[model samples]
Target: MVFKCQEDSFLKEFTSKVVTCTEGQLKTVIGGKITTLSCYEVVLEDTIFFPEGGGQPCDHGLMDNVAVLHVTRRGTEAVHFVESALPVGKLVKQKIDWERRLDHMQQHSGQHLITALADIYFSYPTTSWWLGEGESYVEFDIRSVKPLNLDKLEDLVNEKIRAATPVFVTVYEEGDTELRKVRTRGLPDDHKGAVRIVTIEGVESNMCCGTHVTNLSQLQTIKLLRMEKGKKNKMNLYFLVGGRVLQQLSACLHREHQLTALLKNGPADHVELVDKLQKSLKCANKNLQAVLREIAVREAACIKQQVPIPRYYSLHRKEADSDFMSILINEVGDESVLLFLTVGDDKGGHMVLYGEPATVAQLGPQVCALLNGKGAAKGPKFQAKISNLANRVKAEELIKQYVTCTTSGC
Candidate 1:
């Protein structure tokens, strides 16, 4: 089914009749968890919202004031998913998110212009494209891209945009005479009806289904940010277009100002100034770590000389890591002494157990269970991360109980 959005991309709001309504599920994965949501599928006779397709995302807006969560296309039908069902045959007012629609249009048009120019200049064809929030990229079927040619392409695309060349969309019947010279990615096997051809003045004429601006000038500007190697030796070119270019430029300038003030240097000198400071910091850290190791050795020696051996020796160091704990444990080596050492801070802690094999073997699993932690053991040393620090006291008690049972055979 042909949508009204296909006719005029600028249509912001419209009244459409609800042709069909059905219940369905919307499944999404967030942070590696699959979530299923109950929704009602509302199919309209016509809509201004663009469904997700052609590497461009779906348009979001209101359907009779109910939030339209997602819009998907099944075969020829564009399905609108909402929380509540709309009454069939009822004429409802549909509103499209204008800002989002315009952004998509600008980016998509910019993509077509760039892709065409790239193919014409370097004979590099676009393999895929992705429209992201504020940024977008197109992958070309080339091993590597030269920077100078990309710069030239950027200039060429902007030149076209500045010219404000008219963009025209023409529909052609199957096996029509005018379809001879038009370039296309080919239609789907079951595709029916007339094909739509989008042309950018004399620059390009390609078959596209996505929405586009009426004029190249509406794109505002196109900036080629960078190029990187992608899968199958393809080159992926990243870019920002229209208002997003201005937004990125503003953010960059703000960051440069902050860096200049903090570094006490000009914006141009930031890279060199930061490099020098980073090297100096590295040298300082190396010297500081040496001193810390010496202090740790002395502390361990003092602890070892305890006249009456403590049943359980526990140490809580705020900044200690696993390696530092290992160094301290090695220096204060006494297999018989059960150590309950907690590293890191109150946000969470890491526990390390050092004792005789018999006691540590049983104590490691018990302490982990008591603290609701996870870790493994090697010989008499056991290390684990404690997610719940409130259980630290209880974990220490369990260690004490194990030690008493092992040493005194209780």
Candidate 2:
């Protein structure tokens, strides 16, 4: 049956008697745990709370101080889901969440205006619409939206919004519905009796049951975000309505200020400034790597020139990479030396091993075990990420203890 919300979208509070109350389960998640909550489905004699239907979310509010958790339609009735049960036939005050209701009304009404304008100007029929968190979208049956059409459409839509046109709903009999030839967003097959039509002044009429504002001005503003290719070659148009436009503007302004300060330039020059900085960083990194390669070569040469080659050589340093380790090993050019090296800080580190094929094959798993880590080895090279810095010394000692002349030339 039709309710007060469909009759008067602006109704906030109303007194209604409870017609029925039945126990039910409301599944909800709290603290990442799924819980089944015992709830009461309370049906009122009449309600101002809109049910979840027609692509619009259900209304949330309170019934006699008890929180109304959910509102859903059961067959032909609007059921209010609450935590505690109220006596059947008892009169109670029902209050709708005005902010939520008004926000939904603005967006739903804005969608009607935009949809109607698109159809009248571009002949693009809206196939579906979605009311999102910060923005909403309408899908058109057309393949693409040309720039000129979009520009003209947006201009005309905003002009209507600025005109503050009146919006009102009318209930039409079955015969009158056909006489008016009113376009609908697909009427349900099971729907019967009179059809409710929402008409915008000099714009369009649509059959809709969702709540809507009384005037176009209530939308405040409507900005078409963009159009993208949708499923099956459909064109999806995104838009923001009312307060969301203001919220998006404020967020964009904040980010612009942040980027301007970070790039040390005006908003207009931010893109150029970022491009220059990225190029500079790339060049600086190339120069730094060249210097590091030279240092790695020198260090390897010193280790090679030692009077007697050590059986085991372990080094610990911060921020060294696989390239440096590979370069150092190539400089030594020895199958004899067993090298166990750790690079990075106390938080975490990468460990590498370079030695004869036999030596690395035997010691790779043992070394990883000592470091409380896991890794794989191939031939004379092995690498692993060390999980414990305190185990670094113990890992090095294990390599020394396990070293043998049979595995390596040492």
| Candidate 1 local lDDT, 261-281, one digit each (tens) | 899989989999999999999
Residue-wise C-alpha lDDT for candidate 2, range 1-410, written one tens digit per residue:
67888999999999999999999988767788988889999999899999887788889999999999889876568989897999999999999899889888888998898899999988998999899867889999999889888888888888988999999988877667453667765656655666688889788778888999888988998889999988998999998888888889999999999998888889999888889999999999898788878978987888888889776788776757778778888888887888887777767778888888888988888888877776889888888887776888877777876875444656
| Candidate 2 backbone collisions, by pair | none
Off by over 4 Å in 1: 29-33, 257-269, 303-311, 369-372, 388-394
TM-score of each: 0.90, 0.78
TM-score of structure candidate 1: 0.90
Candidate 1 overall Cα lDDT vs. reference? 0.86
Q: What is the lDDT of candidate 2?
A: 0.85
Q: After superposition, how far is residue 131 of candidate 2 from its true place, in Å?
A: 1.0
lDDT of each: 0.86, 0.85
